[model samples]
Structure formats: C-alpha cells, structure tokens
Target: MGTEKKEIVGMIRGCIKTVTCGQKLDLNHKSQNDVVKPLYTKLAYVLGLRVSPFHRRQGIGFKLVKMMEEWFRQNGAEYSYIATENDNQASVNLFTGKCGYSEFRTPSILVNPVYAHRVNVSRRVTVIKLEPVDAETLYRIRFSTTEFFPRDIDSVLNNKLSLGTFVAVPRGSCYGSGSGSWPGSAKFLEYPPESWAVLSVWNCKDSFLLEVRGASRLRRVVAKTTRVVDKTLPFLKLPSIPSVFEPFGLHFMYGIGGEGPRAVKMVKSLCAHAHNLAKAGGCGVVAAEVAGEDPLRRGIPHWKVLSCDEDLWCIKRLGDDYSDGVVGDWTKSPPGVSIFVDPREF
Candidate 1:
C-alpha cells in the first residue's frame, strides 16, 4: 500500500516535430526563391514530464521518458527533442545527463497580458484579414527561408483553430473604402503598399489550461485587488481582469514579418488587433516566440512578468543514419534573426 500514492504519479507527452524541406535554411534574413523541395523524415518533440512528489526516487519519471522515446522510435522518428527553461537546472540535468540530449536553440518567450480595455488600432494602420491563399503566398514570398518554418504551412493556415492571417498596411494604401476593409487580397498583394507587415493568430486556449503556481501571497492579493477594484469601480478603469495565477487561456501570434520604414509600426497595430481578438475570446494573454536577437522584438507586445528571456530547447538524434544534410547539425547552428513558430506546433 505504501508503494504508491492514490493518484497518477508520472506522465510524459510527445508530438511530431516541425517538418522542413531538403534545402538549406537561409538565416541571412533575406528573402529566398519560393521553390521548396519536399523531403520527409520523422522528428518528434517530447515534453511535459511530471512525477508525483511522493513517487520521486522510484525511477517512475525515467520509465515514462523511456516509454515516450520508444513510442517515437516506433513511429519512425529519426530524432526526438525536449524543451525547458534555461534556469531550470533540474530539467537540464535530467534531459542532458540522465537522458541523452544536447543543448539546442535558445528562443525567448514573449507574453503580454490582455487588458480589459481594448487597444486602439491606429487609424493610420489598416489591418486586413488575408485569405488563406494570400497568407500562404505572402509567407512563401517573404519568410520561406526563416528557420524552423513548417513544411505543411497550408494545413496550418486551414486549421480551424487558426483565426486567420492578417496584414497591416498604411491606411492611405487602402483605396475607395471608408471602413478600410479590403477583400481582394490577391490583387492587393500584386501591387503592394509602400510598407506592410503580416502575422497570424492561433487559438491556444483550446489545447490546454494554464495557471501560475508558486507566487507570493502578497502578489496574488494585489492582483485580485486590482481585478476587484476595476469591476467595482468601472470609472477607475482597470488594466486586466482575472489574475494569471488562476487558470487562463492564451492566444499565440506567429509569422510576424514586415518591410519598409513603417514595418515596426504595422507590427504594433497587428499586436493591438491580436490583443482585441484574445480579449474577445476570453484569453488572458498573448504570447510569441522569436530569436533572442530579433529586431522586431522591440515592437511586439509582451510583459516582463509573464515572459521568459532564454528558453532552452534540447535535442537528441535517435539514430546515426539520420541525415540532416541541408539542415545541418541544428544543435550546432547559431541563433538566426527570425524563427518561425508553426501554429500547429504551438
């Protein structure tokens, strides 16, 4: 009876990795030819390992990890990987030491709280929802060379969970429309505006619920008080509803790229548009991941309290014959300017 607790003790989860074409990924931050040669390989991601406190030291966690790896192997995965906070030494040691893995990409997590008050979409910025075809065209035309870009981009865009890709351009570029809505995305793309940015939104809330644990009592109280004061005194105007300490949903922004001097401003407007979408859907926060040195980092909305600067991702090759050829030993590659966070992966 003392051998185990009356609860689920250990667990681990795995998902297919983001697929890539055979050609080399260009990290130069320059646009590339739209042609992509298809190549198929099995790469999977493993994460969300947990073991009950009372069941520690019994090797339950190790067993779970091993089982997941075997499942990946059975599914024809050539490589498997995992991720954790850079500062989480326990996770690092467990993955890199006990398990056979090596240090990989170090991407930053940017999270911005959704304010109860709607963000004002700039009048000068006209954000239009691009049809799926147009969005894919834009991505291929501009960001096909981005690192870690998903090979099945069309499927991701068509996924119901995706709200839709959006484009932000100068309002002056929108001709003959008072509401500033442009439906003919194809024609518009043919003769594009002077400046523009494109991004897509995915509803992450449908995947799982998130809660903040291990916070000071004072912090919780202060957060609760703010929410209450806002509700009790509407005129006072509160920042956001519901403390993140409680279970909350999230909206993820991806494929953020643009051109021209006003690119950054367009990104901000899209962020505002994203925030509004998140708030309407009852999501408490918006999150995005990009290279640590991305120039666009200064433009995206994010809060320090809910963000992680150096998120560590680790990987391991399951077999020796697995050829990375054009991809190279990504574990050895330097961080690039932009990293495409596939909506399907998030």
Candidate 2:
C-alpha cells in the first residue's frame, strides 16, 4: 500500500527530464541503467486505455488509473505496468508524476517495411512451423522466465490472431518428426542444433488500423518515391521504408531468440520469412518490440525512420515486497538475458 516513486529503465510521464533525476531526461537517448529483471512474480499490464474528449483536464485519467491499480491490488497482483511512446509527454506525466509509476524499460518498437519483392530466406536455413502445444512447451522452457511473458502462453498461441510459431534451424535438423505426444521442454532443448531461432507471428491487420499523420513533406515524398522506385525497378533492392501515411496492417513477431554463431543468420532469415508472409497477407509492415539491450534487436531487419528507437515502459508496485532494506531497490538489479515482448499487449 506504500506509493513510493523510483526510476528504473523504461518509460514514464514526467514534468519531462528537466523535472529532475539530477539530469535532463532525454527521450531520444538510450538509458544506461542495469537490467532490473523479474523473479517470476505476479503482475498485470494496462492497455486499451482511452478517455472521452469531454473528460480532458479533469483528472479523469489519473483517477481511472488509480482505481485500476486498486483493483490490481485487490486481486493480489504484485505489480502493474504501463507502456507508451516516449514522445507522449502527457502520458509520461500522468504515470511517472501523478500516479507514482516510475520508468521501467526503454524497449524499441522495430518496424520493417514489406517490400513488393519478397525477402529471401537463406538456403541453408530450414523454416519449420510448430504445433501450438510444441510451441507453448518451447516458450515455457526458454522464455517463461523472461520479462513481459504472458501469464498464459497457451491462450496466445491458440488465439485466432496468432498465425503460427516457426523455428529456423540448420537444414536436416528437424526434431519433431513423428506424431508422438509433445515431449515437454527439456527434451525439446536436449540435443538442440548448434544454431537455432524461434518466434511466433501475430496478425495485427484486423485488430488495428495504424496511419502516420502529419509527416513532413520530404518524408512523405521519400516514402512514396521509394515505393514507386521499388515497384518500377524490381531488381534494384532499394532501402525503402514502408509507406505508413495511409492505414496499414502489421504482423508482430514475438518471443524471438536464438543460440550459436549462425543464430543471428537464422533470426535474419526468419525476419525475411516474416516479411514475405506479411507481404503476401497484404500487411504493409512486419513489426516487433525488443529491449534496447537485446542482441536480437541488431538481427531483426527494420527501417530506422519507421521505428520508435526508445519507447518507454513504466511500472508500479502494488506492495513493498519489491524492495530489500539491505541492498537498496530491487528495481535496479541486473536484467534478464532478453525481454519477452508479448504481442498480446498490442
């Protein structure tokens, strides 16, 4: 029941960085804070929040968030968090200042354009579609311990929006061959290939219609020009970003990670595979959100201009268990290997 404010790594609204952490907070700059990871605790994420235009400046949003937090506390949730764009100052202030939810993470939302030409998957890499059960088992084994992983992965993998889960591995290394029961996590990880990557694809085309408004004329010109040039000259392989000016669909790839030297190769191939899938489905973009420090960020292909380099996440503790009197705040502890960006939140 203690409402203490503390800064971690992600996003929160404030009076802005000039508001004081002993330094000016710059949304454009990446945070250098150590990873403050989870210990498999109970938590809830806030999403789909909106207020009527008539409710503006009436402290309605703040009250609503407080009420939700009370509900979370009543339900025994140990923590609650909110995610928003870094440039959204109003949202930042509402949470970080008024609501006492300090910054938690600065993950980037990586967005890749779906070009007219298909992105090629490497020949040496074999892409395999996974059964939902098998995919669930694998996720639990690997990512269940990571941040932002859903409470129930089975529901996510089985949801209609989830296209399927896929794994990229060196060719001739198919593990799930026979029609036997899923062998659980240990066996799946047992004798794994030297290099491998796994990810799930979620179709966001139907749920959200996103458009980029008020773009500078030059940016618009560049986006349009790139599309035209790419379409007109198929072999040129231009680095054209997606045209987000109009409403567009997005395919979100989540639970991404890999091992071994060629793991990066597998991830890139999987991204290309995802790009091809999105293009065929008429989605304008293939997207993902990864912790800024996750090496996977370097592997996933995306356009810099089209992506949000520093989207923020803010978290509040429902109780005082998050702190240890002897060692300072647990929020400043080292983070996990990678953050599990649950597409369900989007």
Q: Cα deviation in Å at residue 8, candidate 2?
A: 34
| lDDT by residue for model 1 (217-320), tens | 99888888877776677665557546688899999999998888888889999999999999899998999988788888778978787799988888887765
Query: Candidate 2 residues 200-264, lDDT tens each?
Result: 89999989879989989998998888888888887887766677889999999998988888888
How do all models score by TM-score? 0.82, 0.80
274: Cα error in model 2, Å: 0.3
Off by over 4 Å in 1: 1-8, 25-41, 174-191, 213-221, 228-241, 321-327
lDDT of 1 at 36: 48
Using alpha carbons, what is the TM-score of model 2?
A: 0.80
